[model samples]
Target chain A: MQLFLLILLGIGVLILQSAFPFYLKVAGVKPDLLTAILTLYAFIEGPLPGARLGFIYGLMEDILLGRFLGLNTFCRTLNSYLVGYAGQWLNPENPWAPTLLAFISVWLHYLFLLLPGRLAGFRYPLLPGIVNIIFPTALYTSSLTLILFILLRGGVSWKRGRRKAGE
Target chain B: MFPRRRYSLFLWMLLGGLALFLMGATGWRRDSLGFLEIAFREGLAPVQKVVATVGSRAYGWIEGLKSWRGLQEENRALKRELERLQALNIQLEEHRLENQRLKELLHFAETQGSDFRFVAARVIGRNPTNWYSTLTLDKGERQGIKRGQVVITSKGLVGRVVKVSPNTAEVLLITDRECAVGGLILENRTPGVVEGSPEFKGYLQMIHIPKEAPAEENQRVITSGLGGVFPKGIPIGVIVRIVTEPDGLMKKAIIAPFVDFDRLEEVLVII
Candidate 1:
């Protein structure tokens, strides 16, 4: 049931990511909701499950984009696996955990996506791409993750209270 | 423990290998979509279209509310501009007729052929990632929007159709890194290739201009039609700045496009 809910959430995020960014763009960059959600999920779960979900989400994006078929999958899976591994030691209750993880995840995501293309003789200006796109997007995603973390925690506690009352 | 670790390593290796193979297969461009990809895109396009419409309308309402206080003053300014344009329209109409007569004398119609047929499409969604500047249109193969067809607005050039489904098409905006067009400076007739600049957002760079070419700021740029992909004489943008390359071989002009890509709602694809 939780897995089903997460998939629905992924679809909602994908649709909103494409549609609502027209209005929410800052400095020509939009927050990456997928990275934020994946980071949160991986931090709560474990490496194997995180990597599995990452592959699924990344595959959906790749199919929708219809370009660089495996690029997002590889990047996202690696990001999730590493984050999930690191998350085992960190305190998920700390607000900084998910925010920092999201920031780093998005940063690494761009590097993984671009580095291969750059090696293949694609002329992506590395320095400008880092400054103009990668940093802004990471910052935006991290900020969004912070807010989502608080909201999610609040909702979880509320559900817990409701279950306690029923008991 | 040792066996479990080895099994995990094997899984990682398998995932990596599969990813590498898929990447190698697709490369920079995938000329066509697989059946599954087409089916998914077709299935989701309608939902996307409805969401985009509702979102834009809500955005418009919010903007309207925010600017409610200034509407009367804006309306007055618009009225004045409209009156001036109405007077100018008469003069332009006369000049247009004269130009038509001149075109007949020069047999321009035979040389240029008929005007292009256009298929109008509404923007349904944008590229999900910031790495690419692309928009998905509601009309596609069924509407005769083929890959490489030019997309434009009333103001200027937008981009070209790169991917098409039965009910949708994707346009690579002129501001994206991969897009390039042959452009000419209207004032001096200087020809150069305009390419999207990564350093800046919402601007293009006109490259390969001879160092001695008389290109200047605010000069209008138009499609040169050298490339068969785009029609000639379509307005592109105005040069806002010019810079010399490090090697000093050529000059580059920065163009501010007439189309406001952020606000683009509808586009016409040259069919």
Candidate 2:
């Protein structure tokens, strides 16, 4: 049931990413909900399930784009695995952890994504893109991560607490 | 704990290697994954279509809420432009009649005649990646929307259909790095290829302009019909700047596309 819910959540995030507006974009960079979700999930669930979920969600994202197949899968899988392992030492209940993880993971994910593309003879404006595009995107995703984490974790507990109070 | 950690690390490495292999192989063996891609897209397209409808409506509401004052200013400007266009329309009608008579006398065929059949489609989804620009349309093979079909709006050329399923199609936008359109300067008839910029999103560049050719800022660029996909005379963009390529043998011009890709809601696929 938990696996099913996670998959559903991943799909929901993917759909929302598509539906998101350009108005919400900062410096032409939109928040990455998938990265935030995977980061938090990895923090909560640990390495194995996190890696698997990342791979599945990343593959879906790549497939949806219909190009550079498996490119996102590799980055997301690797980032989630690392984040999961790193997160084992940190407390998931710490609200700041997910935001910090999101900021760091976005940078790590883009590096993994860009390195392979560069090796394949693709040219990207590495320094300028990092400064102008990638960094802004990471910040945007991190800010969004805070909200998502609160809703995912805090909202659930609040509901439980309310139910206990009602009883 | 150390052994368990070691096993996890080893497994992650193996998965990483597998992903790298897939990435390397995708370029060479695209056909291997074609079926799976089509199936996934088709399966999800219906839901995307519904979601896009609601989302666009919501976006329209938000835009309407914020743009009332701006719309009033725009309305006045449009009225002024309309009066000017009305005068120009009379002159253009005379020119059109003269051109039609000449074409009839010379027995010239219309370039976009029977050969061009258009399939109208709604923009249903957008690619989540920042690096690439793509749009998913709610029309597909069932509607005669095929791979490589040129997509356009009444305003200008939008893109080309890259992947198609039975009920949906993915259009690689003109701003995407992978897309290239055969283009010509409308004023001088200088031929060039309009390609997307990797460094810049939402802008295109027309490359391989002949050396010493007159390329001017704000010059109209249109489809040259050499691509065999896009029809001739379709407005692409205006040349914003002329810059020499690094090779020194050619020059490139930055183009600002006429169509607002961010607000694109619907498109016509030239079947």
Candidate 3:
């Protein structure tokens, strides 16, 4: 049941990412919601399930774009796995955890994504791409991560409180 | 514990290898979609279209409310522009008629006749990533849309179709780094290759102009029709800035495209 719910959440985020980000873009950059979600999930679930979810969601995005087929899959899976592995030692209850993880995950995600393409002879303006696209996107995603963490934490505590009342 | 650790290592290596292989196979060039990609894109396109429609409508409502005060001023400005255009239209009509008569007398063939068939499509979605500028159209192979076809709006050139499935097509916008077009300055007939600037968002750079070319700011640029893919004489944009190359042999001009890519809702594909 939890797996099903996660799948549903992934789909919802994908829909929001693709369909509505145009209106919400800041400086021609949109927040990377998948990175934030995967970071949060990896912190809670550990490396294996996080990697699996990343692979699934990343593949969906690549297939939808119909170009650079497995680029996102590799980036997201690796980032989620590393985040989840490191997450084993960190405390999730810390308010800054999600924000920090999301910021690093977005930077790592773009690095993994652009490096392979650049090696393949694609001429990308590395400095401008990092400064303009990557930095703003990471900052935006991290800010969003903070809000999402607060909301999720509230819901979890609310559920626990309800369970205690029933008991 | 030892066996579990080994299994996890093997799983990571396998997934990573598969991903790298897939990227190499599909990323280097414009490969045709595999069966799996086509199936997934076709499956998800309808849902994307519905969501995009609802989202755009809501956005339009909010923009309308926000701009209610400015509409009257905008309307008055448009009316003045319309009057000026109407006067210019009459003069252009007379010139066109005279040009047609001269062509008939000279036995000049109509080179542009029957060279184009446009397939109109709605913009349903955009590229989800910032790395590329692309749009998803509601029409595809069934509507005779093909790869490498030119996509344009009434305002100006948008881009070209890069990928197509049974029910959808993808347009690589002219703002994307990978896109380029053959362009000419209308005033001086100076030809150059226009490419999307990687360093700038929402702008294009026209390169390969000889240092001596008479291109200038505010001059209109149009398709040279040198490339067989795009037909000639389509308005591209106006030159906004010019810079001399380091070698001093060439110049590049910055262009602001006439199409509002952010607000594009519909496009016509030249099949």
Candidate 4:
């Protein structure tokens, strides 16, 4: 049931990302909500489940974008797993956890996503891609992570309260 | 329960293998739509459309609220603009009719063809990433949209359809790095291939034009009809500047595209 709900949330975030303009985009780069969610989920749930969620969400994103098919899947799954492993030594409840982890995850995600295209002889200006796209996207995703973390945490407490009231 | 480190390694290897397999499969095939992908995208279209509509309405409401105080002034300005446009429209119509009559005479003398058949569609969504410029249109194969069909606005050429589902199609905008168009300079008739410039936003570049070709700044470029992908004579852009490569044999020209991609709302696809 938790997995199902997370999947639904992933879909909703994907739709929102697709349908609307980002509130804080620089150089036409927007925050990646999927990366933020995957990172947060990994921090909360640990490596295996987080990797699974990442794989599913990444696959859906890849299909929806209809560009490179497996690129997101490969990058996101690895990112989630690494975050999950890191989570074991860190506290998820820390306010900075999602922010810092999101920054790292987004950086890794772009590295993985762009490296293959660059290697394929696609001419992405390396310095500009990093400065304009990767760094800005990482900062944007981290900012979004703060908001999403609060919302998810609030949702959990709310659900727990309802369960207590019923009891 | 945490798996053993070796077990985790095995899982990583397994998923890595799967990712490579998918990459290989997708790379081996140039088609974006397989049967399953078509079904998936078709199924997702309604959801995308609904979300887009609701989001747009919400955005409009917010914008309208913010500007409510100036509504009367805005309305008056719009009315004045409409009247001015109406006067210009009358003059343009006369010119159009004269051009059509001249074209008819040319057709009788030279066997010129009719205008292209097109299907109009609304822009539904845009690319989620900044790396590419793609737009999803509400029309698809059901409305005669097909892969490789050229999309255009009233102003000029937009892009080409890259993927089609039952109800939605994805257009690869000409500004994206991957897109290339065969172009002809309106002044000198120099033929070249215009491709999206990676370094510049909202700009295109035509490369490999002969250095001796009299391609000047502000010259108009149009489709050359060399490639069957786009129709002949679609207005592309105007050359902004000529670039001399390190090697002197060929030259590049910077172009400002005719269609404003950022403000695109609707497009007509040449079926």
Candidate 5:
């Protein structure tokens, strides 16, 4: 039940990301919300939870966007497990760590998405698309991640409090 | 500069990076569509309605202000119109003949035997991306709409349905960067393909017009009928300007589209 709730919650965040008009053109720049959500979950829960969350969230996005199957699935799952492991050393309470980590996560996601498109006989406007996806989303995702991480901490602590009371 | 413990996490991110690399490396990309997606899209209906209600109220208020000033002006105009009607009444028979002559070209669409289910829809959302000049229609599968359906206006052809869901569908507007139309140069008789420019340019470029074609500025451009997407002979736009390559091999012209897409509200979905 918790796992399903986490994945659904992540997808809800992604919808907010897609529905956001961060750019003047509106649809051009979409902040990586699922990436941030996955990152936050991975840091708090560890590797196994992170990977599972990532896989489920990616599948939901695939259904939502009507995208190519297994494409987002692979990228998102891998990032979650890795970020979860890396999250061990960080002070999850520190606002800036989550902020910086989100940039790295989104950047890595962008790079992965770019690689296959270039290799498979697709002509990618390499430098421009990289610049478009990476730099623009970095700052926006950072601020958003910071806020989301704090909210998540509050939720987690509240759950822990309830469990302790039951015991 | 890379943190050592985090270095391992980098490898996982690398796999994700690697997978995206694979997607980009190939020409194939997945585009998803199913009933659940359609339902999810339809789920946006409430949000759109909220925005629309606020917008309609704002528009109504502004229009009310303008109408007050306009009504006085219209009263004066009506006096002159009364005298003009006296003259028009005598020439009514002649005017009716002229109307039939002008409408002869329009008769073809009505006569064509095609199964059509018309759905009236509103423009609910627009692509928040710069590359997209597309709009999302408020009607979808619930209205029996589907991909490849034609969207037109009382004016003329608008575009075709490219993506669909249960209650909503995304329309590839004629003005979008990815949109292209097959058009005939009415004067020169040369057929060409028209696509949008990336300079954040609003106008269209009709490419590969033959040099032998009698091309000139300000000529009318219409659908060539070669592309199966749109019906032939619909008015596209007028040539605002033209240019040629350095070698003068093929010509390209700038076309100003007839419909002002930014202000679009109502459209007819032909299913």
Candidate 6:
């Protein structure tokens, strides 16, 4: 059942990614949907399941972008695992709580990818990108999460109703 | 079975990293990758078609609302420019030399028993989340574009044909991490490799020129055409900053790319 849920999560992510670029085009900005989804799922599931989902998500992205094939996978898996580990200390039940953690984790995820590239004497203008894009993105993503929280609340109740009727 | 999932995750990542390092180190570029690239293009073609169709319809409606006078003026300008190119064709060899010359040669190159003609392709995909600039063009094998063919703009060398499909190609811009152009400092006459500094801010870094090579600020860099991939003397960019090695035996510099990526409406592919 755990593996089944994980697979379902991945399928959901692929559909999201497939549909995301269009949404980005409409909005004129690329929101890191994978990052948002992975962070959210990592908080829901434990680190292990989260890492598995992250790996699958990353592979699909790397395939679609045709980039350094596994780079996205490695980076995303690392980010999701870190977020999952952090979830241990947070109250996922609180509506506002996971939003703060997601905000922090996304920044950490970007930082993890940036460090090795920077250490190689490549100057990544971290401050400006974070200041300009990251904060706005976090607020946007938080608003999105709030909307999602309300939506998912409905979805969870609907699922429970179907399950109880069948049982 | 203790933290078994963690162990597998670590193992998978390690193996995956090894695979990526191998691929990068070997520098494997293939025409078949064009299949993947073209699939992306075709997959997105409908979206672009819809956009272009809607954009043109809206434009046409606006044209009717605005005036026919503006359209007539643009037509006159294009005709005048066309005549000027015909005249320039008679006296060339000095300005836009590389593009004209390449096209002249392309008019003669074999392997296409039918002459390989040039066409301008629309810029579709710009590399997302990238400092290194790459562009995907919407023309491909159906147009007789092949591996190792050079792509250029009116200003100069854009990139080479790394991958091509029946309808599209992904151009590894002169600014890609693995793209190397045989280049020289026109003033100093020193030869070097212009490697894409992916981490560089929308530019390329020409690396490993000898210390004796005096590449100063604003020196014009052009392809030496040492390699058959890019024809010689195509303008690349002007040097912006020079990085010197500790021993001072060699030096390199960053080049501000001449191609205005944002406004890349059309580009002529050299067959």
Q: Would you list the C-alpha lDDT of every candidate in the order shown?
A: 0.87, 0.84, 0.85, 0.84, 0.72, 0.71
Native A-B interface contacts kept, per candidate: 0.68, 0.41, 0.47, 0.41, 0.03, 0.00
Candidate 2 TM-score, true structure as reference: 0.68
In Å, residue A74's CA in model 1 sits off its true spot by: 1.1
**Chain A TM-scores in order:** 0.93, 0.89, 0.93, 0.86, 0.79, 0.73
lDDT of 6 at B52: 100
DockQ of every candidate structure: 0.46, 0.26, 0.34, 0.25, 0.04, 0.02
lDDT of 3 by residue, B189-269 (tens): 999898887666779999989988888999999999897878898889999999888799999999999888887776778
Error of 6 at B243 (Å): 3.0
* Candidate with more favorable, higher TM-score: 3 or 5: 3
Model 5, which residues run further than 4 Å from truth?
A14-28, A89-91, A118-124, A150-167, B1-117, B122-146, B153-158, B163-179, B183-192, B195-223, B233-266
lDDT per residue (tens digit) for residues A49-132 in model 6: 778888887787767567567767887888789878888887877656557756776576556555664554434457644654
Can you write out model 4's per-residue Cα lDDT over A30-100, one digit (the tens) per residue?
77888888988899899999899999998988888876787788788888999999988887788588789
Interface RMSD of each: 1.0, 2.1, 1.4, 2.1, 5.0, 6.3
Worst 10 residues of 5 chain A by lDDT: A18-27
In the range A48-103, model 1's lDDT, one tens digit per residue, is 99998898889888888888787788888999999899888888799899899999
Candidate 4: list runs displaced more than 4 Å: A22-24, A117-128, A150-167, B1-113, B209-217, B241-251
Candidate 1, residues B124-161, lDDT tens digits: the string is 89888888889999998988889999998767899999
Candidate closest to the true structure, highest TM-score: 1
For every model shown, what is its TM-score relative to the native structure? Answer: 0.72, 0.68, 0.71, 0.66, 0.54, 0.53
Q: Report how far residue A99 has shifted in candidate 3, in Å.
A: 1.0
